[model samples]
Every structure is written in structure tokens, then in C-alpha cells.
Target: MTKITYVEPDGSRIEVEAENGSTVMENAIMNGVPGIVAECGGACTCATCHVYVDDAWTETVGGPSVMEEDMLDFAFDVRENSRLSCQIKVRDELDGLVVNVPTRQG
Candidate 1:
């Protein structure tokens, strides 16, 4: 299992054991991490699962796909690091991954 950390807008942090091959959104939903409202589940059809990839891990996590970038247009407060958690696949390399949840989703 990979260790993924979700940081809430209020500064709260939730660390969970995410299985490799599963999307970050899945782990967040399974762990009941606040601020992740995956309205379309892991389909990547909506921006409800928007999150900011922590700066330190951006290079490791990489950028979103064109399709994901289009979907992110609807997310609130989109930024250089903004990413839909559903698009991030968990893996051993991301064992210490850290993502920040916005105050609200799209």
C-alpha cells in the first residue's frame, strides 16, 4: 500500500494506505477524507474531486492529461497545481504523496 496524505483547507491532514493501481480519489472516498466530493466517482467526468498537488511532489505526480485539464475548467480556484484526484493513479513511487484539498469543489 502507498501512503497518501490529504490536507484539508483548514490545515487538517489525513494519511491513508492507498493500494497501488487505485486512483487517489478512491482512497480519499474510502477513507472518508473531507473536501473530496467525487460526484462522478472515478469516471473523471466532473471536477468535484479537485485537489492541489503539493508543490514538492508535482514533478513526481506529473501534469494532468488534456482530457483532465478540460474537466478542471469547472473546478473552483484552479491553479498551477490543481488536479482532479481521480486522474492520479497510486503507485509505489508516490508512497509519500501529499495533496491539498481546496476549501470547496466545483
Candidate 2:
């Protein structure tokens, strides 16, 4: 299992063990992490699962895909580090991944 940390807008942190091959948004929804509405589940059609990739993990996580970038247009307060958690697949290399949840969704 990969360990993922989600930091909430209120500065609270939620750590969860995520299974390999699952998406970050799935882990968040399964673990009941707040701030990720995931209105479209892991389909990557909605921007509700938006999150900010922690600065330290930015390069590791890489940039959003062109399709993802288009969907991000609907996200609130989009930032350089912003990403849709559903587009991030969990793997051993991301054992300690960290992402920040926005104050609100699109």
C-alpha cells in the first residue's frame, strides 16, 4: 500500500493507505477525506476532485494531461500546482504522496 497525505483547507491532515492502481481521488472518497466532492467519480470529467500537489512532489507528480487541463478550467482557484486527484494513479513510487485540498470545489 502507498501512504498518501491529504491536507485540508483548515490545515488538518488525513493520512491513508492506498492500494496500488487506485486513483488518489478514490482513496480520498473511500477514506472519507473532506473537500473532495468527486462529482464524477474517477472519470476525470469533473473538476470537483481538484487538489494542489504539494510543492515537493510537483515534479514527481508531473503536470496534468491536456484533457485534464481542459477540465481544470472548471476548478475553483486553479493554481500552478493544481491537479485532479482522479488523474493520479497510486503506485509504490508515490508511497508518501501529499496533496492539498482546496477550500471549495467547482
- Positional deviation of residue 19's Cα in model 2 after best superposition, in angstroms: 0.8
Candidate 1 residue-wise lDDT, 1-106, digit = tens? 8999999999989999999999999999999999899999989898999999999999999999999999999999999999999999999999999999999999
lDDT of 1 at 89: 97
lDDT per residue, candidate 2, 31-56, as tens digits?
A: 99999999998898999999999999
* C-alpha lDDT (0 to 100) for residue 10 of candidate 2: 88
* Each prediction's TM-score versus the true structure: 0.98, 0.98
**Candidate 2 global TM-score:** 0.98
Q: lDDT of model 2 at residue 66? A: 98
10 residues in a row with least lDDT, candidate 2: 35-44
lDDT of candidate 1 at residue 83, scale 0 to 100: 93
- On the 0 to 100 scale, the lDDT of residue 52 in model 1 is 98
Cα RMSD for predicted model 1: 0.5
